[model samples]
Structure formats: C-alpha cells, structure tokens
Target: MENANRGYERLFGDDGLTVGATFPLTSARTTRPNVGRELALTERLEALGFDGLWARDVPTDWPKFDDTGQTFDPWTWLSRVAARTDDVALGTASVVLTLRHPLHVAKQAASLDHLSEGRLVLGVASGDRPPEYEAFGVAEDERGAAFRESVEVLRAAWRDAHPEVETRWGTLDGTLDVVPKPTAGDLPLLVTGNSRQSREWIAAHGDGWLFYHLPEDALRSYLDDWNERTAAPFVTTCTVDLAGDPEADPEHVNQGFRAGAAWFRDYFRELDAWGVDHVIVGVRGDDRERAYERVAERVLDRL
Candidate 1:
C-alpha cells in the first residue's frame, strides 16, 4: 500500500478540473451487488487515469432516496478499493454525519486515510434520510447542531492526541483518545448541501464544498457569489449516459444529462471555465462494462 498524503494534491493540483467516477458501477436497484465486477471497474478507472474513486455512505435502505449507493459499508468497501488500486483518491461522496457517532466516524475515516496512504477525502452531510432520524433516535431539529458538532469533533479527533469535546454525540474527555490518526493527520471535510447550516457557517467550518448539479447560468452566478465569500473549491456531481453518437447534443436527465462524448467534452470544458474544480460522474449505460466502453475511447481518450 502507498504511504503518502497525496489525496489532496491528486484532487486539487495546480491544474484544474479533475474527473472521478461514483460507486455502484451498474445502476442495479437492489441492495445486492457483484463486488468482483465493481472492483474490476474501479481498477480500470484508475488505470484509465481518472483522478479519484468516490464511494457513497448509505447506512440503511431508504427507498425514497432513490439510489442505494454501492450497497456496501463505506469504510470496508473503500478499504478494499484502497488496497486494490495504486493511487486513486478514495472518497465518501457524502457520509450522513448526524446518524452515526462522530467518534466512530473519525476512527474509520482516519483508518481509511492510513490504509489509502492518506488518500481520503471525507464528504459529509447532516443527512437527508428522514426515516433514519427516528431509527437512529436523532431528533430532526437537533440534526443541524449535531452536524456542526460532528464536524468539529471529527477534526479534533484526528488531530488532537486527546481531544476534549462535548456534544450530543457524547463527550470526549482529554483523558480518552482515538487511535490510528489520519496518515496526513487531517481529512478534507467537504460539507455537502449546507446540511441546513448557513452559507456563512459552511464557509467558516468546512474545508470545501460538494454541491448538486445546477443550471449553468445559476452555477456561474452561485460560484461568483461563493468565490467572493470563500476560496473553497466548488465540487459537484453529474450522471452521464453518453449517447452512442459522439456528436449528439445534450438532453436533460435527472440532475445530469444524456449526451455524446463530444457534448461531454464541451460541457465539462464549460464547467471548468465556470470555475468548477472537480466533478464526480455516475456513468449510466446498458451495463457497467458497456458504460466503461462508452467512456473509454469516446470520453477519456478525447479528454
């Protein structure tokens, strides 16, 4: 396994606009997955020169959310990926921070960072899973505060040898400690969707941002406003179902688009011009292998 903190450099280099692929290679709705195939594709993605490999955290099955991200435990799955790949950044697209204890989150995140040789970018959120609140016994109103506390605790836990923090997740006295600190001694805590916190709060506390796909015009305006407020990198996601015809124009899909590789290059170029730092794409096709084929010569080769 590699043993260096290159995750940050790999994602945010002097050059701009890196690309990554999201988990669940196939859009299979069921919770079960063909782990062997997913791993194979992950290795392929790395070999193909994608900058990162993003995994999702879905602690429980919540159909309303519409997607079962990878259908595997984020920690275990990412650890396996880290061991398999040589140097692709390992990330959690958005871990529901409020639902789990911050200590446990810190421990797992730190461990993954080490195993990946400091290639962990933790994307976190207060959680949008409504039923999970009741299941985890976390009150809805308390989630925002809980989210803030979790971020603070995670940062402290990874850095301070014996951090003293008190929150709804429980108190961490200076006497106690969590082991296996991050390989870099820090994890880029990128907050997703504000988590019901103010933009000011997000800018102040978060190391970066992970937002949903927005209209190009709105995105430009939003980025300008955000840039004026903070220097954080603006990150987003796209679901791509590349058309067989490389010259086809883009048509709207859910939070993304269905287009040809030619359109994809221009689309991504537009994002780069608009100041987008990185994009995590969820490939959509007839199957996982077909999706890779569509992206290979058509997309990656051109880019």
Candidate 2:
C-alpha cells in the first residue's frame, strides 16, 4: 500500500494529529434511535468543521464498569454514519480485538473504508472485561496474545494477497483474500492504551495511539515516552460536557474534561501544543443539541 493512501495520513496528516469529538448519537437516546439521528448529526458535525466522529464498541452491558457512554456496535454505527456524511471521518474509540476474529475485523473495516471513501480510523485494544472474555471462551491472560495475533492477521489480510495466518485462535492457509480493499489501500489502525503490549511493539507497528484523559503533565510525559520510541502520531479520546455558559466552570468525568466553551478552547489549544494530533471528544451529560451548537459556534471555529 502506498504511504499516501493510508487513511490516517489522509484524515489527519503526516503528523497524525487532528481534532474531533464523539457524537451523541447513542448517548442522546431520548430524541431518537442512532440510525435516525446519525445522518443529520454527521452533517451537522461536518458543517460545524469537526474532523471526525468516533463510535464505541460494546457487545454486552457491564454495570460495574460504570460506563455511561452508549454501548453500540462500532462498525454498524460507523457504516450508517459513513452513508450519511460525505467528509467527516468515522472511527471506533476501540473495538475489542481480542474477542473477535481478525479476519472478520479486516473484512468489515475494509468494506467500511471503501464505502466511506477511505474515511475509516480503527482503534483496537485487548479487552479487559473478564466476564465478556469468559463468555467468548477466551482466557483473561490470553488477551494480549490475541490482540497481537489479531493485529498481525488484519495487516496481513489487508496487505498480502492470499496471506496465510496461524495462531491459537485460528488459522488461514491462503484460502481467502478479503475483498473490497480499503479505498486508501490501508485503513489507519491505532492502538488503544497499552493493552498488555509493550510500548516498543505498539510504537513499531501502530499508526497511532488511543489514550484517555490524563493530567497535562502526565499526558505530556506519556506522549514524550511514545515519541521517543516511535514517530507514529498519537490520538486521545475524552468525554466532554460542553456547558452553555462560555465561562462555565470545569467538571470531571471518567476520562473527560468538563468545561465551558472558553475552557474547552484553551484545553484544545493546550492539547495541540502538547503534540496531540487528534482528540476524540466523547459527549456526555449535556443538552445534546445545545452543547453541540455551542461547540460548533465557539470551539470549532477557533480550532
């Protein structure tokens, strides 16, 4: 695959840095179902000048995780969003690669990439939910291995013709060649968190990194560490509760920064300064329309 044809390079840049937000399609369920609001919201986001819309992959409910974000199938939601918007990029905050077959992921992602005209950014991680892993008949400790294997398989399937893949999970002996190759030749793949993999491997293989909210200093340190090891860019996702008042005080969510428009603007500037290439803002606990409007009016213009 040509380097210029990589989705990450096109969506972000050579630096791999862009600013984006998580759409409230799933979280703001009171208004309508995801499919109903997807197109309009996507168009709104693109019109508002946002770069991308990130979706989450939640196969099952986990009350203990206290995950307030909507649990939707990332691929399906992205496909719907892709059909709706013409420019804004589509992504998964992460799809738990350990639980699913890599070939399945490669095929679906390639199809989505082609359908979306090469606007797919894939974030993958080793699943942490013990119960979910157990249900899938995969041991907890095996997640790391599974994650590595999945990455290898997906890359091979996408780049190699009739590639042979073998691992404990499964094996493929040149019997299949996934169809609908990515429009960009390769889909951008970001590694979310450490996922039990070493920084060296992640830096070497991943196109980017997906991380959560951390203190400025901590985030800077992490970015420095990642940069030291690899030139690949980094991507971070955060839950944001945009306040109506431009001067509203900042609050906190699990991995979000709760602040008014003014603060949000400054925060993004800081992130940009810190060398964060792209930020996927997860919208939670806000008046959906008003919050998005505020961001569009105040923050998007400035970014």
Candidate 3:
C-alpha cells in the first residue's frame, strides 16, 4: 500500500467516485468482438476523461454463461489497450488466479506494469467455473487455499528480491527472482468478489475490493460494513443499457439496470455519496459509441 502506483491513484487516489468502462464495448453478445473498434472506443473513452479502461479474464469460453468478457486474454489485451491510450488506468476485471501459476502471473503482471508505465491495476479472482478448473487440472475445492497462496506469492515476488516462498504451486528459493518488479515498486491488487476468502482476510491482505453490482440498499449496507472493516477502497461493476428516453425509470437487468441518462446521473450521485471509489460501467446497448458518449455527457459529467 505504501508504493501505490499511478493506476491506483488514477482510480482511487482521491476520496470520491471515478468511472471506467469494461471492454467488448463494440459487441456484447459474442465472445469475440471487433478488436480494432474496441481499441478505437478505448482511446475515445480516455480522451473523454474516463479514469480507467478494464479488461476481463475469460481464458476459455463457457457456453452457458451469456457473456465472455472481451474474449481476449486479459494480459495481452490490456497490453494492447495500454499501447492505445496514455494515462487511463489499465485493469483486469480479474485474472483467474486459481487456474494459473502464481509465478507466471507475477512475471506477466510485472512486465505489463512496467510496459504500461505503472498503469496496470490487477483484480484477481478464484475462478467459479467447475469445468474450467477440471480442464486446468486444478482442484475445485482447493481453490480458496490456492487463491490465498497466490496472493501471498504475488506479494512476495513483487516486494522482495528472490524471496523464499513455498505454497501449493511450488517452492521458490532465495536464488531465483521474478524480474521486472512493478513500475512503482508494487501493483495495486483488488481482490474480486470474495474469491472464497473471508472478508476479514481480504480487508487485511488486498489493496482494495472489487465487487459485482448490487442493489442500492444492499450496496449501502455492504459499503458500511466494509468501511467498518478497513479503509481500502471499494470498486464495483454495473452493466447499463441506456434507454432512449432521458427520464426513463430503472428496470433491473443482468448484474445491472436498464435506465435513461437522467436516472443514471442520480444513481451515480448516490454511489459517490455512499463512498464508492470507482464504478466500472459496462454499456450494453447496440450503439455502444452512443452509450459511451451519453454516459460521459449525461451521467459522468453531471457528477
């Protein structure tokens, strides 16, 4: 927490609300989206003064799940996003830590952090797909322990030189080290969901918490509890399908709501007042460019 990097500051350095958008802005229904259009939209968002651009980690496509989250590997996709935009915080909505090797994750993350000039903010999760876990040869039940160990290993690799470490993944002796430490000497890691760990544990170990969209009253209660537990920032994602009418009422959608610009402006105002640090907004309508512009003009600017 001492060496909080540029990305962290971009998103949570201040004590108010900042807005970001999730990828696949070009297409929401399919796993693969038009990459060129996505990048173009990304640059536009940054130019419009959005604080962050987040990438999702969907290593393998699951048919039952409706959304695949940009379809590209988070690291490589984020690297591309980093190259396209300057100053926008680049983040992983989360990397599936339980399915990957911690050392590899450490190297990839550090490398990305440096290449992005310290703009990488990592949101890591213990994956939920049972079949994917089987495919990766990781035990489903052990993911919680794996998730905890991964966190410890990541911290050790970034903070210490050739730090001796042992966990379910492997053992690292003092002889070897993960090269290219993060640009600011450390990366801000926000634990996604609970990741099968206790809230107390996450509050103690993580730089922040990344949560899914919740109803207003539920979110307020959760935020109050989080405030009581720790001072770490809280980040949440909300999908939006902006209605054509400016004064439309909010209708519940998957993980978010469908509403008009007027309603969203008031909603974000409430979130800011409730102490939510950042909101990663996912626009869901067909005309994403229009949705982006509307959010910036009507929702973000109003706040």
CA lDDT of every candidate: 0.83, 0.76, 0.89
> TM-score of model 1 relative to the true fold?
0.94
User: Would you list the rank order by lDDT, best first?
Assistant: 3, 1, 2
Worst 10 residues of 1 by lDDT: 1-10
**lDDT tens digits, residue span 1-303, model 3:** 777888999999887799998887787777579888888998899988899988888888888876677888888898888888889999998999998898999999999998899899999999877789999999899999999999999999998999899998889889898998888887888999999999999999999999999988889998999989999999998987788898999999988989998898888888988989999988876778888888898888877
Strongest candidate by TM-score: 3
Candidate number that wins on TM-score, 1 or 3: 3
Cα shift from native, residue 299, model 2 (Å)? 1.8
Q: Estimate each model's TM-score.
A: 0.94, 0.90, 0.97
| Candidate 2 per-residue lDDT over residues 153-229, each given as its tens digit | 88888888888888875787998788767776677788999988999989888888888778878999999998788
Candidate 1 ranges with C-alpha deviation above 4 Å:
1-4
Counting clashing residue pairs in each candidate, in order, gives 0, 3, 0
What does candidate 1's lDDT look like per residue over 115-179, in tens digits? 88888988899888889899989999899999998988997898899999887778888999998
Instruction: Tell me how far candidate 2 lies from the true structure as C-alpha RMSD in angstroms.
Output: 2.5
Best-performing candidate as measured by lDDT: 3
